[model samples]
Target: MKQILQSLSSGITEIVEIPCPSVKSGHLLICTRSSLVSAGTERMLVEFAQANLLDKARQQPERVRLVLDKMRTDGVIPTLEAVQSKLDQPLPMGYANAGVVLDVGAGVEEFSVGDRIISNGSHAEVVCVPKNLCAKIPDPVTDEAAAFTVLGAIALQGIRLAQPTLGETFVVTGLGLIGLITVQLLQAQGCRVLGIDFDPKKLDLARKFGAQTVDLSRDEDPISAAASLSQGRGIDGVLITAATKSNEPVHQAAQMCRKRGRIVLVGVVGLELSRADFYEKELSFQVSCSYGPGRYDPAYEAEGQDYPLGFVRWTAQRNFEAVLDMLATGRLDVAPLISHRFPLEQAPAAYQLLNSSEPYLGIILEYPDPQQPNDLLNPTIQLEQEHTQTKAFPSESHTKAPIPHQPVLGFIGAGNYATRILIPAFKQTNATLKAVATTGGISGVYAGRKFGFGLATTDPDSLLNDPEINTLVIATRHDSHADYVCKALNAGKYVFVEKPLAIAPDQLDAIQSTYTSILNSGTSPLLMVGFNRRFAPQIQKIKALLANLKEAKAMIMTVNAGAIPPNHWTQDAAIGGGRIIGEACHFIDLLRFLADSPIVSVQTTSLGGVELREDKVSFTLSFADGSLGTVHYLANGHKSFPKERLEIFCAGRILQLDNFRKLKGYGFSGFNSMNLWRQDKGNTACAAAFINAIESGQAAPIPFEEFVEVTRVSFEIAEAARH
Candidate 1:
């Protein structure tokens, strides 16, 4: 499948071949017919991407602040690399699409194979859209017209906020596509509408859509016209749909609206406001979110759980259906709104026109053979690369490795962590970089070239089943860890999987049974979970310093985890296994390693906060060796604070590690403070251990038993949190 991807580094859009995403449960696999390019929103992203580093920094000062914070804790070199890696990622473009359902996943009954539907899918040849974001198209609506459904929902949502009525007079600030759509929809409600824009062509379209035009290009003032058009009574409401950094739209909206009138913003603009302008009229201002209520809610869109109509009258999907019904009838005419059309292959030229002053309204990208299905849609597309440079290695104790004759590595997932940390670590070893695989072939291409992989592919199963690959690294999503581990164990390959191993008890049981069965069959492939913190040089030094002490140690570990949005996948238990299972396992494992004992028993409790819903929890670990450890993982901390702090005490001697970059020892004879130029979370040692295990035919650095223990403890903590 071919999809349009925008490079943030170069702001270049190219059609690249990638594996068609598999249809997941409650989702539809759609073959795209046409997709709409939202001019206002996409143009901003493109321009931002095209900007220089300094200009980009100027545009998003918040991110710059974050970079500074990272530098303070992680050091300058790591922070710069982090920023560059983020900028190098490919951002998928477009959201309004019309397509035929190629297949439907489990429990998706509303639409099935061959159903022509409109969705919030991107400009891809194939897309797996969640069922809630996918709406069935009416019989009379053409694909191009249906492609406007998602964008139409945006306009409808803004009007919904304005609360227009039959006898009301409303003004739409800006005659863009959304503004024009809002005009027609408001007119359909029997409201007198006036549209404002600097472009005469947009104003002309607004006039054709049954709106009174206020052309700023012709020096027509919207505020004066609104008062005149409303017979000196002032407009009932204003919908600001303009995209600019100027606050003029809101100022004019305030001036045009009557007393106690409503103002809804459906676009981006400078929000500098005068209190007096709004104070005298007591006007209401609201910024309509993307599409509608269910747009950013994970339970609603991702989980396909629709809000009941009795409780929430209009969801994003409901808004999409409403727009489609209007198009099916003659009430809404998007056919005339489309000013330009280009085939999907020439999407770059369409964007160029949108970026230029070429005067386009509803730009649509038509797909070739819209209803046809490719014979090999799910086949793995090998991402071939010409150069595979060996990465440079620093003079480090952990990274130095003996050259191996037959070590082959197949890595799954080429995401940020893998690209920035693990793969780079593995490249310093003697292991042959056999293959790199990811869901998207583009990322695989990038990772393969950068890490010197022999082959880059879209199929993890192919890499796993290959006899040439003796080792496999599973760095994919949390939900996928268990399955990949089981597969690798069954394939007789040494496995290094990132934590946490499993989310559910059944998954853990499956992994344990598979690993045990493989071991019983005289096949002992080393199994290691990515618990890298314990392998850190700072951590190792602490362990050796406390090696002779028999007294129990008391440790306190605080993780100022900051905030992950409630709608992020990390908060979704089914996807990311919640933060505790997905992330806190590292802390749990590190405590066990430092204590030199398994966690005998544990209890957990979470803090409650208003408005900020996150997992702010505390847990106590009672080790078998009589050591006690407490973990305080707080998400409400300020971004400027150092994220992690650990203090351990034994026999009144204290050891402190701050953010893994600096270590301080107190009440001890020969140690004051040990510092590093950059933070090392032991990624180098972690990767080297796994590669060295295969090379030396030795056991894993961290045993499989410890992996199971940490995974079990995490699950228990989550279970306790439920109460």
Candidate 2:
């Protein structure tokens, strides 16, 4: 499928060929007919992308602070690389989409195939949108008109917050698409409206929608206009829908609003407020979220959970429906609002219009009709490289006949961790990069082209069934690890999965059973969990130092795992397996490796609170060799603090590793200190070990039994922490 992508590094907008996304459960696969380009929002994105690095840093001071912190801990080169990698990613554009349901995944009962709908899907020929983000279009509404539904929802949501009443006077401080829509919607509710904008064309459109106008380009004062239009009485409410850095709109909105009146911001503006403008009036100010209530909620949008109609009254999807109803009844007219249209292939020109001085409002991109099938509708496409630079090492081939054990690689995910760490690590090895797969398709294509992968696919099955690929790297979500592991094992291929082999006990049992069956059939391929910290240079030094120790050792691993949002996927128990299993397992495995003993017993202590925060807990592992280790995996720490610290005490000697970059020895001869210019968590070494094992037909780098033991111990620690 050819979809529009904008490069953040170069500010280049183009349509690129990528595999079409497959429909997942609770989602609808829509073949797009039209997608509206949000001028105000998209213009900001394009301008930001086009900005120089220093200007970009000036625009986003918070991200600049984060980069500086990363530099402090992870070193200069890695931090710079991280920032560059983030900028190199392609950003999908557009949200207001109109399409026909080409297919529906399981549990999606709201719309059927052939049903026309409006969604917040991006500018793509095919889009897989959650049911909560989609609403069926009425028969009377045209596809072009329905493409305005999501933007209309944004206006409606802002008005909903304003709580407009009959006979009320309202001022919309911007005559853009959303501003014009707000004008019409407020007029429909029997309210007198005043629209303000610098554009005369937009001001004329607002006047056509029965709104009194104040043209900013003419140096007209909106506050004075509101006073005159409302018969000397202050306006009942003000909706600031203008996009500017000047604080003038907000100050004007405050001055125009009546005492105890509402001011809802539905656009971006400087927020430097004059306290007296709002204090004396006791006015209410609220920044309206995009669309409505269920917009960014994972449960509502991703999991198909809807807000209760009676309690919430209006949700994002409900708002979409309301706007469509208004369009069907002619209460809301969008015909004059659309100023431009372009075919999907001409998306670059449309985006260029946003950056140009040419006036535009509600630019729509039209897609091919569903009846006319095209290659863009296909879920799979071959990625042909103009230059074939991918070379395979002449190592022995194992599973498939005539194919050497040269470790042909198929990566199942191209997420941040995979792209920044795992993929780069593997690219350094002797493995042949075969294909990369991702659910969304954009990142897969990006990673494929950037790393010289033979193919980019949305389907993992195709990669698994390929005869040439003999190794699978599962860097997908935690919930998918075990299933992919079993599948890869059954295919007689080596498996290297990221941490937390399984999220559930039953999943672990299934993986064990699958591996056992493979073992009994004499075709068991190696399975290795990504416990990379154990392979770190510092940790290896610690292991070598402890080799001759005879007494029991005491090891302490303090992880200043910084706080993420409670709603982050890693904190979700079902999806991310919580921090204990998702991340702290690395520490657990590292300690176990240094101790070189089985974890015979375990104990855990959590914070004393009503809400069980597994992220802030401590656990102790009693090893069979009498070596004891405690992992303090606490997220309640400052970001400026070093992230990870390890202290080991064995036989009158001590070793301390700080943030995987520096190590200090205490009371030890010939080894007082060791340090690195950059942080090294052994990611490269781990990848090399796995590849070398496959190439030489040797046992997995870290024993398979140890992988299972570490995973089981992590599960046990989680269970203990819960209580």
Clashes in candidate 1: how many?
0
Sequence-dependent TM-score of model 2: 0.97
Q: Please name the candidate that would achieve the greatest lDDT relative to the true structure.
A: 2
Per-candidate local distance difference test: 0.86, 0.90
Runs in model 1 with CA error above 4 Å? 370-372, 390-405, 436-459, 603-614
User: Tens digits of per-residue lDDT for model 2 on 592-637?
Assistant: 8988989999999887773647888999999999999999998888
TM-scores, each model vs. reference = 0.93, 0.97
Worst 10 residues of 2 by lDDT: 391-400
RMSD of each: 4.3, 2.2
Candidate 1 structure quality by residue, lDDT tens digits, 1-723: 788988888889878777676677889989998999998988888898889999999999998999998888788998998898888878889999998999998989999798999999999998888899989999999999999999899999999999999989999998788988899999999999999988888888888888888878789878789999899998999999999999989998999989999999999999999899899999999999988988888788768899999999999999999999999997888888888999988988987886796778889899988333964266455444445356322123223442443467889999888988888888888887778788756677677766667666777888887777778999998899999999998887888898889988899999989988988988786889989999899999999889988999999999999888876887778888888898988999999999999889997878865443336889999999999999998888887788899999998799999999999999888888888889989989988888888877788898889889989999988777655
Error of 1 at 219 (Å): 2.3
| Per-structure clash totals for the candidates | 0, 4
User: Model 2: runs farther than 4 Å from truth?
Assistant: 370-375, 384-402, 610-612
